[model samples]
Target: MHATLTAPSARRTRDRATLVCGIAGLASCMIVIMADFTTATIYERLGLFADTISAMAAGRGAMIMDTALLILVGGIVAIAFGLWRQRLPGWRWRAVIIALLAVAGIIAAIALFNEYGDGDVNDSWTFHYRLVYALGIIFTAVPLLAAHDLKPIDRRLWLGSYALGAAWFVAGPLMFTVPTGWDGLLERVAAGIMLLWLIGASIFLIRQPDGR
Candidate 1:
């Protein structure tokens, strides 16, 4: 009877791992989305409050740069752990890094048009908000999309989150005709969805066996 119980427990453990991996993958995407939106909020400050904050940020641009780098690393780690735990060896660190560099480059290029680039101090720094957002989006989307062993629940959560990626992509060029604030609204929607997905995944996984 004890041996029979142990056999069932071990199988249950394996099943739990699948759930955890799925949760990790979902969390990774959500984290990237949240971080990206955060950087965008800081970037889109055309109001007095934004100007004040940007002024302060510009004064210590290097600090902001360092902070962005730290987040970049943290994002990478989260993504790697999610992939490893979930048995996705292919879309691991290499994917995260390549996506990061590409997205960062795009945002940095866009930052040149902003007011911050007026001085040498700003030029010395490399924390382009757009680049970060792009990186966040790509990294989050790629991992979940490519996660090989996704359970049905994982697919349900991620498929919904993937729509935001499309929404942001479509909204990007549309900003030229509409208002800049329009992008902010879309980002807020994306942020909310990402948060909800992460929370939901957490609740689903918390009760499952940790060994799984």
Candidate 2:
């Protein structure tokens, strides 16, 4: 009887943790979206279509963007641990956790190194561009990696993950093909798709009592 009671108690504890992490994930995305929007609007000369997000991070109000990145890192870390507690079969859980943690590390680095400071202090700019590209691929893969597991939990989310991947491919790789000045627009398109997947995935975990 004690063992039986313990099992349910532990499960409930985990469920609460998963729920909190899911909420963290959602909150992080919302915060970053607001920061991006606010910062983008602040610089009137910086064309939203022509200037990259990195450009927004470079000059004034960069602190806001950097702070958002750090918050995102925290959110990703929570999601990684939360997913690890779920019952994903085979290597699905491991893959998802690795991807989430990797993203968290990358974003943390971006936030710490920052785009301010003169003349590439600590060579942050060099690391920045490469990591940005790496982020596009790895983040896009998150939905693809977890789609199989998500199918059973939520069909709409499962289908949406693949759809998000397809959009990411177009926005990421094909951005270069769509005229030079429009790259930023394409980048934002990819980012929006990513945000959708994050929110969907977070909701999936939040709604599941056992974090299925």
Candidate 3:
């Protein structure tokens, strides 16, 4: 009886940890959806610079604004989780990185929208894209690698997903460069791909454990 009770107690603790992570992940996913919606609209305004999201501004801005609010609220919730739960150092860093990258991605998307297909890439725009992509990639992957705080299966998922992510970012300089025409679809596409990838990884990181 004592052994059975101990097992249940331990299981409950793990379940709680997993639950918090899942809640956080779900919150973060909502933020990404908001950001992506805005991006699609802005890209539309930019003339389908991406596969979708071509020529949407007011709508996109509204979405981005909503996303920002969601992110802020999510952060508050996350902070409460961290404070109340025994989060691992790895999990803490993961949360921090996720926050930073999401913010940077939003800023980059907005900057691109403002550029509005000037037909000329400015130094600042160029710099922001490079920095945003690189940092986003690194942050998204590193935390996955360090995510030992999670269960063994979660750690494995992090390893596989992040490895591909890391490889993608490392090749950014070569794969993503300035476009030569009125439509730099490739560059925009790459950026979109990175955002979605990070979003997916973040979701995985945030998910609550099952059967814990």
**Highest-scoring model, lDDT:** 2
Ranking by TM-score: 2, 3, 1
Better of 1 and 3 by TM-score: 3
Off by over 4 Å in 1: 1-69, 89-115, 121-144, 147-153, 175-177, 180-212
**lDDT scores for all predictions?**
0.46, 0.78, 0.49
The better candidate by TM-score, 2 or 3, is: 2
Per-residue C-alpha lDDT of model 2 across residues 4-93, encoded as one tens digit per residue: 979989988888988998899889989988888888788635667887666677768678888887897888787777778776887865
Per-residue C-alpha lDDT of model 1 across residues 1-212, encoded as one tens digit per residue:
89987998887776676465555545555554544445445653343222322332344343453344344344334334443444444544346435534544443443333345455556432544445456455646543443323334467645654554455455444433445535445444544443453444344444345543
Model 2 local distance difference test score: 0.78
**lDDT tens readout by residue for model 3, 1-212:** 89987997897776676466545645665665566555655544444443322223334464564445456345434433442344556555556455554554555455344443435456645654555565555545433443443435565655655554565555445444445442345544544544444444444534534422
Question: On a 0 to 100 scale, what is the lDDT of residue 107 in model 1?
Answer: 37
TM-score per candidate, chains pooled: 0.44, 0.88, 0.48
Question: What's each prediction's clash count?
Answer: 3, 0, 15
Ranking 1 against 2 by lDDT, winner: 2
- Name the lDDT of candidate 1: 0.46
